[model samples]
Target: MELTDLRKMRGKQIAVTNGLILTLLTIYFVMISVLDVTFSVLFLILGISILIQAILGFLKSDSTKSFIPIFEQVANYEKQKMGREWNKQRRMGFIWNLILSGLMFMQYYFSRGSTDHVFQIDFTFMFVITLIALGLINISLFLHIRKVDRSTSELDMKGYTWKSSLVAVVVGVVLAVASIAFIMFYILSNL
Candidate 1:
């Protein structure tokens, strides 16, 4: 086969295998949850299924380009600008969470002897701390988005094709609504 044909074949293989593996995963989770099953020999079936899937994924993704690396390459822009910012922002978020945790702990620890607690205990302090934590999270998220946008300013990395994207979204919404309806019907009928 010509190089072009080989590339096309690989792309098709990748798409098909990717779709199948993900669908299997969705089915596995849904069945496990819906049937109220647990760890057993049946789980071995899930394991083997996933192993086969990984092999198929590796086979299809053997070419120079893979999904994650492509996405990273797009997002990182030059020499990991977005990546560095992401790591830095992630650490900042962790630190903020730790600070929040400590503050909450202190608030609880010091107020252990108080007659009024939680909802009635220092409402202003609780509200202020909660607001600050929320604001920090929002600010960090916005900053990350800004950094990513700045990095990928020039490159138009359209992750999905317009038609397929639309179709996928519509199908997902339909499935979700239908599943909810089915579940409600089942519950109501049982009642």
Candidate 2:
């Protein structure tokens, strides 16, 4: 195959994988919202499903060993494709997050004025912490977009550097930790 054809195949592969995952998530969320399952049962099922998913993800990556350096090449192709669609996606994310955050702040403000201690306690310190952690998520997304924007036509690791890779790893870890902390905080607070 020509070099361009190879790159196009890889890019399409990555896009297909991402699309499938998003489709599954959408289906899962829709099902969960429609079901009236108890919290304990839901949590148990979610935990087990997540564990299975991690194992499957590992196996999939292992099986695709021939597709080495997925990060570098896949990113370059996606970046090239990230034209108006990416801009639209970014704008939608910003608008949705802004509206969600505004609703959260409104809830917190109203809770404080109410005499109900339960609601007030629920939305107090942890809520603020969650909001701050959300900034980390936004930062990670921005970092990804910046990296995509910096993608160059030259392949073979010509554009990416060790420092940038390290920064990406650090940001990813921070986002993961923040996400776990938020989940834990929510569980504990609700209990």
Candidate 3:
């Protein structure tokens, strides 16, 4: 509700998400080759960066929620503008995270293939960069929120109504079935 509470919540979200990201990446690296010293060091650095960010975020707490006086009322349209700005940042984060996740899945799948990967450096570097970006996304979002309105930036108007949710579900299911059918068709046709 208040920015102070929101900051703490965001700090937790950042720490937890970044921790999980590191864990997943570490697991993948281990599965590929547990004893690779080069990658192990890189992972350690990434872990440290995430840890420091989390600590800084946790320590930096805002005491006051509103820059405006307590008695001042935020205009309705300014409230809408803040809502829109926060939502925009949220959407950006979600889109980028999804993109990075897809890239990671593709890398994981290909890395397990029989052929030796000649482009390992190129692909791995991209994945690592994207992973870092994903981990820092929360901090970027927090900055964006602070810019919008310290008091209410963390507050969200429900972007999705029930009707919109149902439509999204239907579209998702349709796309999934079509993708599966297409894959089956390709395999069967090749056979």
Candidate 4:
């Protein structure tokens, strides 16, 4: 493979790993909240790392020549139209993360102070399961991005093979869902 191809592959791998880490941290947050577990700062660091990786991935993708012209054109037109809305969405994501983190910390403090408080066992279990499902969805998205990157690389080297990319996407999504379901069930049963 060419150096550029390798770089793209590496970036895709990093992005996927970051996505998995983000999903796991989100699941941890939900589990802690529902079960009244103590909040760990480590999850905050992980979440931040995920966000950093996501930004890095986006920047790296944009650095490629293929996307630059299109991005420039979009920027020129959107700057006068939807730029503020786009910025708002970005700000909202950051704000939501901050709020969630703060809430988790507050919950931890409260739970720590009141050991006698009864936690809802069923709801805790359900929350964890649902978070796992959401994690799987994110993982599926990451895998899809990776598959598309790899397919594009392969096409550049070995000519077009439409079926390969399609198959990769399908398999990646299937595995992501199956893994999530298995993990959720296992965690629920054990809890």
lDDT of 1 by residue, 1-191 (tens): 34464345445544554555456645754565456443432333444444454455445432223465533333333224333444333344344444444554555455545544112223454344445545544554344335444444323322213433365468658867976786577558757
Candidate 2, 155: how far from true, in Å?
A: 14
Give all candidate RMSDs, comma-separated: 17.9, 14.2, 13.5, 12.3
Alpha-carbon TM-score of each model against the true structure: 0.28, 0.36, 0.33, 0.31
Find the number of clashing residue pairs for candidate 3. 0
lDDT of 3 by residue, 90-163 (tens): 34434444444455445545444434422233355546555655745665545534544444343443442233
Task: Please give the CA lDDT of all the candidate structures.
Answer: 0.45, 0.51, 0.48, 0.51
| Candidate 1 TM-score versus the reference | 0.28
- Candidate 1's error at 35, in angstroms? 32
Model 3, which residues run further than 4 Å from truth?
34-114, 118-139, 147-191
Model 4 Cα lDDT, one tens digit per residue, 1-191: 45575466546555655566667757765665566542344344445565565455455442323343443433343233333443443344455455555655555555554445333345665566567656765666465445434453332323122344466468768977987887678778877
Stretches of candidate 1 off by over 4 Å are 1-81, 120-143, 152-191
Looking at model 4, residue 23 earns an lDDT score of 77
Model 1, CA-based lDDT: 0.45
In Å, residue 147's CA in model 3 sits off its true spot by: 4.2
Model 2 Cα lDDT, one tens digit per residue, 40-147: 444445555544544554454323223446544554455454544333433443444444445445555544444432222334554465456455545654565455
| Candidate 2 residue pairs in backbone clash | none
Judge candidate 2 against the unseen true structure and give its global Cα lDDT, from 0 to 1. Answer: 0.51
